[model samples]
Target: MAATSHPINLEVDNETLAGTLLAPQQRMPGVLFVHGWGGSQARDMQRGRHIAGLGCVCLTFDMRGHEKTLQYRQSVTREQNLQDILAAYDRLIQHPATDPERIAVIGTSYGGYLAAILTALRPVRWLAMRVPALYWDEQWDTPKQQLERARLMEYRNSRVAPETNRALSACAAFSGDVLIVESEHDEHVPHATIMSYRAAFQRSHSMTHRIIDGADHSLSSERCQQAYTDILTSWVSEMVIGDRIGHLN
Candidate 1:
C-alpha cells in the first residue's frame, strides 16, 4: 500500500514544534522518531516514511531550537526537551489510526538518550536507539566523573542531574524490548558511555544490540545509512508488527 505524509505542528507549553506524520493505508502500531541534537525531523523523515510503509504510523519532529524552531533554541531547557518528547508521544497515540497500547520509538544520539528516558515515562512497546549519547543532567559528563562518583560514597544514580537521573531510573525499571545500535568507527559517544546505558537496562525483557562497522557517529556513507535503516526496519518488523500479528493468529 502507498504511504502518505503531511506536515504537523504541535503545541507545547509556550512554543510550537514542527514535524511530519507518515501514515500507511491501515491502522497499526505507531512509531515516533526523534532526531539527534542539532538535527531536525528531516534526518528521520526517510526512515519514517519507510517504516510507515510497513504498516505503522510514524512521526518525525524537530526538537526545540531546531530547524523550524531555531528561534527558540536559546530559551529551550532540558525539562522542555523532555516535555516535547512526551507531547509527541501523546499526539501519536491519539491519532485515529494508531494502536495506543502498541507503540515504538526510534531516536538517534541526543534523541536516543531522550528515547531511553521516554520508555520509563510512556507505554512504549519497542525502542531503538542509535549511538545514544549519555548526559548527566543534560550536561555532558565524562566517564571518569560518572565512574568516580560511583566509587564515592555519594549514590551515583542520585547524584546525577535531575533529567539524567530520571532517565537512568526509568531505564532501570523498564522491562520492554530494546535495540541499541553502536557505530564501530564512531568518534563521538565513547565505549564507556555506551556501556553506561547498557548497564542501566538490567531489567529489559529483550535487549538486542548491534555495531555497524565502518560507520561513523552519523553513519555518513550511503552503505552505512542503508545498514542503519535496514537494522531498524527489521527490528520493527520482528518486535512490533510480528508480535502484533502473532497475537491475532
Candidate 2:
C-alpha cells in the first residue's frame, strides 16, 4: 500500500487543530481515522497507510487535549471531545472527495470513545474500535499507566462500564452495523466492562467480535494488527456492498 500524507489543520470554535490527510494510490472511499489520547503516532500513521492501501482516503485529526488541543483546553472530558468529533465528522462529510453515505469512522482509545458517542448522530456505515479506552468507566489513572497497559498488552475483559452505559443510552438513535475488536488481556478495560455496554444493545443482526488473545490495550501485536486491518476491510466491504444493494433495490 502506498500513501502520501499532507498536513492540515481544521477550525472548531476558533481553534485550529492539527491533522493529516492520506490518499491512496487508487481512489475507493473515505475513512476518518482518529487517534487515541496522545494524538498522532506511528500506529495511527500505519493505519492510515493500510486504509489508503485499500483505496480509501484517511484523515486523522487532533482533539482538544491532543498536542494541538492541549494548549487550548482549560479542562478535558469525554463530553468535550465529543464536540470536536462532531466537528471532525462534519468536516469529513463535507470534504469534496468524501461521499457522506460512504464514509466510515475508525477511532482508537479515547477516539474510539468519541466514535461511540457520535454513532447515534447519523449514517455512520461501520465502526472499528481498537483498545477503546474505557476510562470513562474505569478509574482514571496516570496517562502513563493507561498507555503502558495499552502498549504492554493487557486487554482481557472489558470493565469499561460508566462510559459504555452512556454510549449505550445514545446508540439506539444510531443507524448502522457496529464492530468492536478489543484485547483479551487488557488491564485497562476488562472484557466485562465493555460487555456491559453491549448488554444494552441487541447484537447487530450482523456483527462479530474477535479477541486478540494475550494482547493488551494498544493491540500491539503484529498479528493482532493484521487482524484489525482485515476486520476493518471486511467491514468496509460490507458497507459498500450493502449500500449497492440498497441503491439497486
Question: What does candidate 2 score in Cα RMSD to the true structure?
Answer: 5.1
**Which digits, one per residue and each the tens of the lDDT, describe model 1 over residues 1-249?**
578888898899878898888888777899999988777787689888788878899998987878887776666665678789999999998888899888999999878878988887889888888998765543422222233333322332223432346666777787778899999876766656666677778788889989998899888899999999999989887886677677799
Q: The CA-based lDDT of model 1 is what?
A: 0.79
Clashing pairs in 1: none
**Candidate 2's residue-wise lDDT over 113-188, tens digit each?**
6686677775676776776654343433233333345532343244433334556554444445666777877756
All candidates: CA RMSD (Å): 5.2, 5.1
> How many clashing pairs does model 2 include?
24
Instruction: Estimate the TM-score of every prediction.
Output: 0.86, 0.76
Q: How many pairs of residues collide in model 1?
A: 0
lDDT value, residue 56 of candidate 1: 91
- Candidate 2's TM-score: 0.76
Task: Give the candidate number with the greatest lDDT.
Answer: 1
